[model samples]
Target: MQNYTLLPEWAKQEAVILAWPHAGTDWAENLVNAQHTYVALINAVNRANAVVLLLCPQDEIDAATAALASNNQVLIVPSEYNDTWVRDYGFLTVSDNHKNYPISFTFNGWGQKFDATKDNQVNSSLAKLCQQPLIENSIVLEGGALEIDENQHLLSTASCLYNPKRNAYMTGDEYHTLFIECLGAKKVTIFNHGHLEGDDTDGHIDTLVRFTPLKGIVLQGADNRPHDPHFAELFKLQYEVSQALPTHKIYSLPLPLVLDDEGTRLPASYANYLIVNQHIIMPIYGQSEDKNALVIIQSAHPNYTIVPVLCHSLVQQNGSLHCVTMQVPTNTIKPEIIAKAQLGVSIL
Candidate 1:
């Protein structure tokens, strides 16, 4: 169990981590397009903070280095990985009263669906890179499956964490106890209702609800339609859960009509937007609804500079802006501490 202190959205972050796309797994049919979009995302992130792009092999590192014209903005680390969803496998950082530490919740490839050997390695690698305490939790958790507020309360879904496929061994309360221990979260409230039919991780809550400062949630809402089985249950869940959690506000953002090509509906939703220090990187579908989604997100986050990232390629691969990258806070500790802390120390 790792005790986590939830950092605010406006916290000063150090850098963002991205796993360079592999051809077979994430890119398969659209390798070139994914790479281009990844580069663009790296470029956008570099404007505000440093970026670490995990290269699969030495050859890939060379190629990525060549592709990224501004090498200084990005660091190509040789790390093998199966998918580009680094947000799930990457380290989750928390700053204690004295020093900053990153907690690596053992990633089992979203419950062992894919190869996560390299993804797990990323945890210690990132810890080594940041020179901070890294607590490895025994329980299975993904960064994508959890959201926290300044008060250390967590927002999550029963669909993913409580799903039998992910953790059939543990009961709901048992799983939540691990969350409390790892995140130091006051409570782990379950969003029990909605299910995104297209979501693969049994409906990740990041695609349904997001916290905006001390205000409330910017949630995805859809009308009940006979053609869509998930709508009714989803709406009921949102309303009931919002009522249960009154302290936290909930704002419904309309869902963009499902995007499909060749009869296959992709995981396209506006709720998967990423929040950086100075900017809110949102996904756009290039549809008329894209404008409305942007306007809604902008209204919710008036303080941030909203950056619309064309995520058609990313969505096709079943992820978006927030899924592709993970942020690491900058360390300004003394040089002597950096050298001493690298060996090891009990963060608690």
Candidate 2:
């Protein structure tokens, strides 16, 4: 099988894909608040990179377009989806010898925990819409579930990747094989522990650990509130990464105590930030941690602009900046780059 080199999120991108919230969807109640965050994101991203905003229920198009009418960088397109988590349903772009292609893997709505029939067709629809080459695969995966370094080493979690609901009967080695043969993974590491309390996506890696462009990790550190349910697991998270990247610089940001009035915890993590061309669109929950998150990211990438998008309502839907935005990487595979990469060489 020809390998597909996975591009890191920190690379230069043409556009950021966002599935906008609407009244006829699950975000109907939080529709106004959610759209506020989405609008902020669209505007921020458009300032530096193009914003691909996907709207459902055709009727909602005019209103969505009207909101961001000022920004010519915002591209509004009608779409059909089970929900608005496009990071999980959207296409993953990989470079095979410089030519870029979008990889479409089966999204089972976070382990088939939700409806994904329409959401599953998103990649093909998007490929036709963008006129990019689409590489279709039946492997169950999500854009938010894996982290790739500049070296193409994939960092993912065991709970989400190997769950029986996603890939039953397939051993861990078999799944690792898919990463190599399909996703262009030179190596694969499965972090076994640590998860958020109300997380439904089986501890997606984006919410747990983020790869810093500085060869470090921006991990979700536990707050002074030692009673947080996932405190013990967070310790394990730090230890696991320290063991993996010994020389890498690790930065820890405080976690917010964001739970619903009914006491349901929301999956809020500073590590779930979206890194675009020259901007870092981070998630803010109106907590003090929001400032620290911004400061830490800004310090790490002083060259890039840091934009914070209020995700209080979006977390109610169990996601944040990175969960909603997937970047479109530039296709740079030339003939020489492909020839070297084909024989187990680095494109970087």
Candidate 3:
């Protein structure tokens, strides 16, 4: 009878976990730009008075350390990983009786679109380093695919969680039951519509919708161009969210239409921002709408400081800031690791 409640992203955090980008992964074509984005993201999170646990491949540790100027708020550990998108493979922390427990779910590389054997094993290595026992589950889920509000209301997309490629064996009803039993979700709201073009996760809710600190929902609106393919679906999504959370205020962020060199639409989303401590690290794609998106998010979270990080390079890979990092809730890590993180000591 463990009363485990899924912690929201805005919960007081012990550390922000990130796996560094390297030449081994898809970022090899633009590794420098990707690393630069990571550096900017790390610096932004560090300034928020939150500890950072950075996992880097052994060969990239020196470069990453130098790039970050050896920031004391960061604890760099040498590790092996298939990719840098740790948000999907990292821990989804829960709390019970005021104590935090990190849950490690099975990540199948976003429905096996990518190689994830090593990515799936990252938490096992991290648990040993943090000296924190992981509450392991074989369920297929990703941190980026779900968002929890302060009231234990969980927001997710049916396209990702219910896709046959990801969980063909489980019905939507089964997932609803699992959410209640494991995450203590009082309400599970699944968005039937909403997706970003070029998104590889089928449809991660983080890329389209997010829960704001003001008890509101800030979701990505379709491109203003009516001819855009995402326009209609996003409109319906907005309506669905409004209906689902009638009591909560709804704020819509303009989705900037950004394309890669190949003319492929990159999933540039304002809703993919990360909330750490009292700061919100928002991803901006250097589009004209970037300023407006910032203003809208600020209105949604007036009490917090909004730190904008340029994510042009990140979106080129079809993801953004929140897709690359995972927050470690307070008390989730062992005291020793927290101590070392505070002292800016590399665990390895």
Please tell me which predicted candidate would have the highest lDDT against the true structure.
3
Candidate 1 residue-wise lDDT, 1-348, digit = tens: 334575654567656778777555668788887888877787677665544445455557666666665444555566667677988888777766646777777778776677778777766655656656677776677887887777776878877887665677988788677767656777778777776766666778778888888567888776523356556866886786678678767767666555657767676778888777778888887866788888888888888888888888888867778888787666622334333323222110
Worst 10 residues of 2 by lDDT: 339-348
Q: Write the per-residue lDDT of candidate 2 for residues 227-289, one digit (tens) a residue.
A: 878888898888998998788888877889898878988888888988888788888899977
RMSD of 2: 6.8
Whose TM-score is higher: candidate 1's or candidate 3's? 3
- Candidate 3: tens digits of C-alpha lDDT, residues 214-327: 889898986565677889999999999999989889888887989999897888888999999989999999899999999999999999999999999999898999999999
Give the winner by TM-score.
3
In model 1, where is the ten-residue run with the lowest total lDDT? 339-348
| Model 3 bad stretches (over 4 Å) | 130-132, 345-347
- Per-candidate TM-score against the hidden true structure: 0.88, 0.92, 0.97
lDDT, each prediction: 0.70, 0.78, 0.87
Name the TM-score of candidate 3.
Answer: 0.97
Please give the lDDT score at residue 266 for candidate 3. 84
